[model samples]
Target: MQYFIILTFFLYGLVFGSFFNVVGLRVPTKSLFNPKRSYCDTCERTLTWKELIPVWSFAVQKGRCRGCRQSISPLYPVMELTTGLLFAFTYYLTGFSPELMLGLLLISLIIPVTVSDIVYSRIPNRLLLFFSPFFILYRILYPLSPFYDSFIGAGFAFLLVLLIILLSKGGMGVGDLKYYTLFGFIFGFSHFLLLFFLSTLYGALAGGILMKMKKAGRKTKIPFGPYIGLAALTVFYFGEVIISWYLNLFL
Candidate 1:
């Protein structure tokens, strides 16, 4: 039974990963809602059903468009596979619960934002905006917790990032501030501060490594959304455990 659930989760990841590819490719160009089938950008030919299979299809085709034999970007398969692994891991961690559903939704939001920010150095507000309502809905579905916590989280995170931006003389982008609001709302006030602290630590460590390797210049900007996404995922999976550990350290 456990094996079956894991297999199901893997298959689910593959399917959603395919959809995420569409979202990542189209959302940035404002073509996500277009009523057209997927097509090869190089050849302008509609992709066949076989070509549309997630990670395996790319590998089978040698990462080329069948119609034109143009070399497709490896990023497609990488994104698909990454999402698939992350989704499966998330399911394994959360199982089939409301938390799992919310976790999946959060993961979906993170992938596009991560991909876009890495490629374009900007996160679309539209994507972050979409996550806002989910906070309210989460509250509705799980009402034992106070909805006000979400608002408090949002406000606190916004102010915290805003202060950092001011101190750094416009170092932070507005999109990041908006994105934190979603994180704050979902995480709530109780855990939001820890999430921010941990995310900032991770982001700084990552950025510092990139700088040391000379892959990024000292002043070269790195997107913060991915770090927030990572921190959120961590909190979702083990918030109580982490909080308890922190409290134990002091006590």
Candidate 2:
């Protein structure tokens, strides 16, 4: 039964992942609701159920449009599979709790934002605005989170981000500050701090490798959204374990 439930969530997540791909592609262009249907970019053929079965369809089609035989992006199936795995893991962690629901919604929002940021080197304020209210309301209803922690997190993170921006002078963008504040709202002080640490560490490692490979130079702009989203997700899912490990190691 437990395994079945996890499988069900995985399947459900795949469906959501397909929609998330739509959101990621369309939201940035402001075509999310107007399109009303999914179509192939190359052939402009509307996809039917058979062609839109998430990862399975991509695999069967060999990642090509049926009408034009043009190659489709591997990101489609990758997004579907990643979302599916995360959904199953989240279900295993939180079961049917409110955290499970909110976490899934948060993932839906972050995935698109991450993709757009990576591609365009910009984060959409519109997307962040869309989810901010939901984050606030979730906090109010849940009431399990610390009261002052979120405020402190928002303040400290905002200031810290602003300071970094000013000191670095165009090294980071305003969108990052907005995103950092959003992270604080979702995670509060302690977890937000940890998320920041992990994100910085990951970003540093990636940047170093990229610079070494000559793929990116010193002035090359790297989008911070993906790293922040990734670190936030990591802290959200494994925060207690990470905290406990730290405690055991130190004290």
Candidate 3:
């Protein structure tokens, strides 16, 4: 019965992931509700039920549009699978607790923002605005250990990122500033600090590898939101463990 519930979550996640892909691709353009149905970008043909079965559809079509025969972006199936696995894992970890809701909500916020960032190099403000109230309400109902940490973390994240933006002069964008600030509020002070460190570390390593491969130059503008999302998810799942281990080493 436990495994069955996890499987159900995974299935729902796949469906939501597909919608998230649509939301990510459309929300940035302000056309989220225009067509009111999924359509092929290449041929602009409305997709049928069979053509919109999340990851299964992509697999069945061999990653090509049925109408235009155009090769589809792999992002679709990948995000769907990622959401599914994360949903299942979150349920496995938290069962029916309130943390499960937080976990699922976090993934929902992360996936679309990631898709938008990867494709448009932009994180839509509307997306952040939409989720902010939910997070606020969540923290109010289930406050952090040190409830004041939310305020401190938000303040620190704002000032630090703002300073970096000013000093680097376009090194980072405003979207990242907002994103980090929200995450700070979500994770609180101590964990937020670790999240920042891990995000930068991930970005640096990826940038180095891309440069080494001659794929990206020194000035290449790799979107940082995805790294931030990845770091946030990591911190969500394992921040306590990592923090404990590091403190033990120092002790």
Candidate 4:
């Protein structure tokens, strides 16, 4: 049974990873589910089913478009693999419960948001707009209250970033504020503080490292959405353990 569950998770991850590829590519352009076909960005030729089979197809085709033989970015396979691993981890952590479903949905949403923000430095309001109602519905269905927790999370996150932006003379972008507002709803007020701290810590550390290595200029802009996504995933998976660890250290 355990092995079966693992296999199920692996298969589910593979399928969802494929869908995420579409989302990552199309969501930015607002072309998701439009034109009803996948095309080579380079050659503009429609991709056949054989060319679209997620990780395996990339391997078989040697990471080149079939129509134009243009070399496709290996990032596609890497994203698919990363998403697959994340799903597998979520399944292992939550098993076959409501938490598992919620985790999957949250991770799925985060993947595209992360990619979109990293690539375009923008988080489309459409992504959050579409998912916000779902978050509310899930909270209601689960009967998790203070129904206002979601709003509180958004308000707090926005204000916190707003302060940073003001202090730094607009170091933070409005896109980040928008992203975190929706992200806060997913995390809710109960964990918002923790998530914010963790994400800010990670983002600062990462940005500092990049600056030290001279890969990023001191003033270079970096997207914050991925850090927020990472922090949310951490809280979802290990909030209790982390909180306990912190309390033990202090008390």
Candidate 2 per-residue lDDT over residues 1-251, each given as its tens digit: 99999999999989988888777777777767784578898778888989999999999999889889999989889988988988999999999999998889779887888777876777888888998998888878775355777788889899999999999998779989999998887788888889999999889988999999999999888888888988989998988899889989999
Supply the global lDDT for candidate 4.
0.81
Stretches of candidate 1 above 4 Å error? 67-70, 144-146
Identify the candidate with maximal lDDT.
3
Best by TM-score: 3
Tens-digit lDDT string for candidate 3 (76-177): 999999999999999998899989989998999999999999999998998999999999999999999889899999999999999999999988999999
Tens-digit lDDT string for candidate 4 (21-96): 6786678787786966878889888888888787899999999998789999786787778788888888888888
Q: What is the C-alpha RMSD of each candidate to the true structure, in Å?
A: 2.0, 1.7, 0.9, 2.1
Candidate 2: worst 10 consecutive residues by lDDT? 141-150
Clashes of 2: 0
List the global CA lDDT of all models: 0.81, 0.86, 0.94, 0.81
* Candidates in descending lDDT order: 3, 2, 1, 4
Question: TM-scores, in order shown?
Answer: 0.90, 0.93, 0.98, 0.90
Kindly provide the TM-score of model 3 when superposed on the true structure, using C-alpha atoms: 0.98
Candidate 3 overall lDDT versus native: 0.94
Number of backbone-clashing residue pairs for each candidate, in the order shown: 0, 0, 0, 0
Worst 10 residues of 1 by lDDT: 138-147
